[model samples]
Target: MSALLDQPLLWLVVTLGAYRLGLWLRDRTGAHPLAQPVLVAIVLVATLVVLTDVDYASYADDTALITFVLGPATVALAVPLHRQLARLRGFVLPLLTAVTAGAVVSVTAAVGLVRLLGGDELLARSMAPKATTTPVAIAVSDTLGGLPPLTAAVTITAGILGAVAGPSVLSLLRIHDHRARGLAVGSASHGIGTGRMIVDHPVEGAFSGLAMGLTALATSLVAPLLVALML
Candidate 1:
């Protein structure tokens, strides 16, 4: 074990191996409703970290190569958006309204709830952009004097919760419009919910991709201003 830990490359191989195992489980289970691959991977990794008594920083160091891919993966979302450009043009106003409204509600509600519960300024700020993607969320948190790590954790939690419950919530609300559903999911959940959307509704998936990109851009521009005003 000490030898494996000493060789950082071994750690990388093991982490990727675990990730692939999780993905294979996702597929083998037919991506079952309960078999969330991200959740599975998180559980697996967490368990391994705990059992091996490996600190998160050490594990993260080994996985930096995988983490580095996130930037390009996020940028790749553009392909789906570009493919749906025509539909996007027609629904521009509605999409903008939905995304803007969702972002405002999500941020405001999170901050308000935390504050009402006696959370400190940092906690409130961290919750401010929990619905946005990691990069935007981290920026927002920093501008607001929040802890970036807390914001990142909140963003991941929000994404996971959204991915798990978004479709059911829409169903309960009787929301049949694919475009509206897609916009809401993307604006609220970011990438994880977008994954579930892609499997359930291709059109919604495309629209969600567009929404995620647009919302990230909008939040990155607006969040700092909002934080400045509030503070």
Candidate 2:
């Protein structure tokens, strides 16, 4: 049984099954923000792996194919951009400015506070790229001399929090524009937030996807520069 569970494809099967279960649970709850599919899936998967006595290293290695797919998945977002090119171009300057400013501020505040709190340089850099998506954050963290795994974890947390709270905050601020909402969520939360925005409205989804792409590009170029300037 243990050997069977340790098969190369076992983790992939378990992952897809757990995610489906998570999606079902989320739908049953009317897709409450707190019941995020990935979050639910993570909990279920973690619990099952512990019960089955599978080591984290083996599980991670088996599931690493999903990371490779993120590249093609991200590239697919360009479809929406192509369809909405005219509208997207009109907002390019403003959106670029927003993403750039947000990236700088996010890195600055995170690194500054961590250093102020007497945290080590490693800890500061780990948290610096929290606002970016997992892949981008991992790359930025590596360039900044931080741990890729730790940056991924922190980036996930930031995405989850942005997805869960972003809409409510936008409502509180009376920012009802779809473009504004999408940009805010994507710039702050990354792909996870964009997923949540898609379920709300098509326009919001498009803008959110654009914001995510722009944010990834801008942050990739800016993160190392920001680190050099500050450190």
Candidate 3:
């Protein structure tokens, strides 16, 4: 048991096993909000960490195998985008415009609000990419001299908030087009909102996927230059 605990591979297996168990439990519970797999995995892993007195670095080392799949998972989103190429072609201009505008607003508003509240410059910089995906957000935060950890926290928060409130917000404004809805949610919220989009409107799922990739690419190109000019 001690030897198993000591091996990084064992730890990796345990963490993933726990996450899968959490997912199973979530599904069996009929997808209860409180039983969210991500939330459960976090609690379970945190408890294990505390009990074992294991540091994050050690846990991360063990779990790097799983983390390494993130890139491939992101790329796999392209399959859906490709499947929906005909739909994509029809709204190319509007999609691009919405994504660009939404990206700019999300970054600017987050950073500006944080700065107004007397947040540190690094915090402000981190806020600039809080609306995008982890890889892009981290890169943007690093380039802008922000704290990556804080950026990650903020990005997750932004995604959750966007997912929770997005549909209602759009409905209140009477914005009913699936394409527009998908673009807005994905540009502002990334994966989490995309998940919610899939549940509500499958057509939106394709556009959301496309928006996520395009927004990441666009933001990656523009955020650094904007930060440089502003700073």
User: To one decimal, what is the Cα RMSD in angstroms of model 3 from the true structure?
Assistant: 2.5
> Scored by CA lDDT, what does every candidate get?
0.80, 0.85, 0.78
Off by over 4 Å in 2: none
Model 2, range 53-111, lDDT digits (tens) per residue? Answer: 89889998999998789889877866765666677657878888898898888898888
RMSD of candidates 1 onward, in order:
1.9, 1.7, 2.5
User: Which ranges in model 3 have alpha carbons more than 4 Å from their true place?
Assistant: 1-4, 32-35, 168-174, 229-231
Weakest 10 consecutive residues, lDDT, candidate 1?
Answer: 222-231
lDDT of 3 at 165: 79
For candidate 1, give the lDDT of residue 157: 85
| Top-scoring candidate (lDDT) | 2
Model 3, residue 213: distance off in Å is: 1.1
Model 3 C-alpha lDDT per residue in residues 1-231, reported as the tens digit of each score: 566577868778777877788668867986544454555666788798888888788888889987899789777777766776887666788878888887777767777788788887787888888878977898888988899998888887777677767877998999998888888888888887786677667778778878888888888877777667665
Residue-level lDDT of model 1, residues 96-171, one tens digit each, is 8878777766766877788788888778888888888888889878877889999999899888888878878998
Measured by TM-score, the strongest candidate is 2
Arrange candidates by lDDT, descending. 2, 1, 3
Ranking by TM-score: 2, 1, 3
